[model samples]
Target: MRRLKSVVTSAVLAFGALAATAGTPAQAATEVRYVALGDSYASGVGAGHYDSASGDCKRSQLGYPALWAGVHDEYQLTDVSCSGATMADVRANQLSALSTDTDAVTLTVGGNDAQFSSVVQACLTKDDAYCKTATDWMSYYATHQMADELAALYRDIKARAPHAEIAVLGYPQALSATGTCPVIDLGSAKRGYMNDFADALAEGTKAAADKESVTFIDVRDAFQGHGACGSDPWINNLSSGTEVFHPTLAGYIAGYYGELDGAWS
Candidate 1:
């Protein structure tokens, strides 16, 4: 990514110099005033290569937003998505990145609102029965309560960037539908619970997207053969207390970039 950034920078500089020499107006390109807003998934928590300037946001070059922005020179990227952000957090801190001039927006939220990280941790540590019960309750709550919050948030995002092409990205299931992996500490039942939770969140998000009349990017099949328990898992089974059970770099590329590429293509 660093090398790619450098190359892009050089190309931009060269292009500018040539345009200057020709006395031609530098490419009057239609800028993609892109603002990325959401939670840890959008912030690239587990992908590493953190942008220290973002402090605890944990933004990484490997993140889908960054990868997309890096390739699209016309994009004036303002990515305020942060690690541990909920819908409320986005309304508070990230939404300010949007405005009337914003031409494109990509969002991946609702996971933190569902307390997804905490649920995963609990499922890993708690007894099977307790884990299942807790996850089931959370899933129900997220599907019911978080739906309103997500709908409102999406409305606000659209109001803020009315002209932008908005895409609400869905969360990929952390675990495969069946079986257990040695790397993931949870039992088979708990693993299934986690998958259910992901489904619940996805359903709520899709509904919210529909309510707001925005594009809903369902990335379930994108990660179909690469869940955390799969032979080539894209999600991290565990982290060194950073962003546990989150998507790894490959996960973001396969689940996010792969699906979103057409949005800008």
Candidate 2:
């Protein structure tokens, strides 16, 4: 990515010099504004290469939004997504970045609203019966309560960026039910619970997207064989204490950005 940045910068400088000397047509004075709003998944918590300017938000330059912005030079990214952000956080802290001039927006929320991370932690540490009960309750909340909250948040986002093309992203499960890893793999039942949680979130997100007439990018299956237990894991594990159970750098590519590339147009 650093090499790519250098190349793009040099090309842009050359292009500008040529345009200045040859009386070429001018490009837009400002790039198309793209705002990213959501929580840790949107902020790239597990991925390294953090932008220090983002502070504790840990916005990775490799996250889908940054990668998309890097490739599309005509677009300017205002990534306000932060780790531990909820719907409330987006509304209160992130929505200010949106407006009629905003050309596009990508959001990944609701998981934090459902407290899915805490649930995953509990499932990993607690007994099976407790895990089953907590997971089931959280799934129900995600499908029912969190869905409503998301729909309302979508309404607000649409109101703020009336002309923006909005895309709401769904979370991917980080573990596989039948797969195994040394000490890091989730038990089959725990994996089932985690998968169920992801499904419930997806179900709600899809329904809300349909309700608000926006695009919902379902990326659950995109990381199918790349879970923490898979042969080729893209999600971080216990070994990676930075942000365990979250997607790694490769995951932001193949699992997230790759899917967005197809649906974005």
Candidate 3:
């Protein structure tokens, strides 16, 4: 009778344990929705082919946003980045691109505000003496006014995507610090201004994001040895091809992978 009682007790305990396990609720998976916004780099202008259906937006399958989307299985992406977006574009135009359910957002802008294409064309047309003066003036304008505009844009993004993890992407080095484009002749002074311009814009971006308690992932350090001057060039010199001083495919991958690894991991 003692043995039978012990067996019954053990069976009862096991059944109770099984019942408890069965009654426990399963953990639900976390869902992430991503929205990408900004200018030509965000749209993957020089990296590769873009969505034909998207028109001048030129959003690419291989762009950083798409690369980020590919790695995160739980993320749903809505990319409305356009080729010629300005700071006003984010507040006025791209605001409509974001949804209330967005969990994460990323942006790259202000190069178009500098009128980069016009700068490059000016460099292509003018003599070296005049080109230096013109580029310097452009860089000064960018460093001063563009920084504030970029900050305002980030603020708008935060307002639009209230619940999202926001990141402001910085532009890679366009001209070589040590190397020169045969046509543009970006000397040390011009290169210094360009570097300063990029750095100022990045600083402004970080400050803006910090005000909103958002993350600012700096891509400059990640692309350190991969500028236009480096052996493994990320941004191509305009002289290299018609795409003219834009990121290569490998550059996009390096930048995107760095951002994803930092944000998601």
lDDT value for model 3? 0.68
Arrange candidates, best TM-score first.
2, 1, 3
Which stretches of model 3 miss by more than 4 angstroms?
1-30, 127-129, 179-189, 239-242
Clashes of 3: 0
**How well is each residue in 177-240 modelled by candidate 2, as lDDT tens digits?**
5557666556788888887888898999988898899999998877887788777887887777
Q: Write the per-residue lDDT of candidate 1 for residues 1-265, one digit (tens) a residue.
A: 4533454454345344433443333244587789999888898887777778889889876677886765566776788999889888999898999999899999999888787867877887788887888789888977788888898998898899989999989888888655456654556777778888888999989888888889999888878867776677878766336666678776776567767875557
Model 2 residue 79 distance off true place after TM-score fit, in angstroms: 0.8
Global Cα RMSD, each model: 6.0, 6.0, 14.7
Q: Which model scores highest in TM-score?
A: 2
Q: Compare candidates 1 and 3 on lDDT and give the better one.
A: 1
Residue pairs with clashing backbones, model 3: none
Error of 3 at 114 (Å): 2.3
Residue 190 C-alpha lDDT in model 3: 55
Better of 2 and 3 by TM-score: 2
TM-score of each: 0.86, 0.87, 0.77
Lowest lDDT 10-residue stretch of candidate 1: 18-27
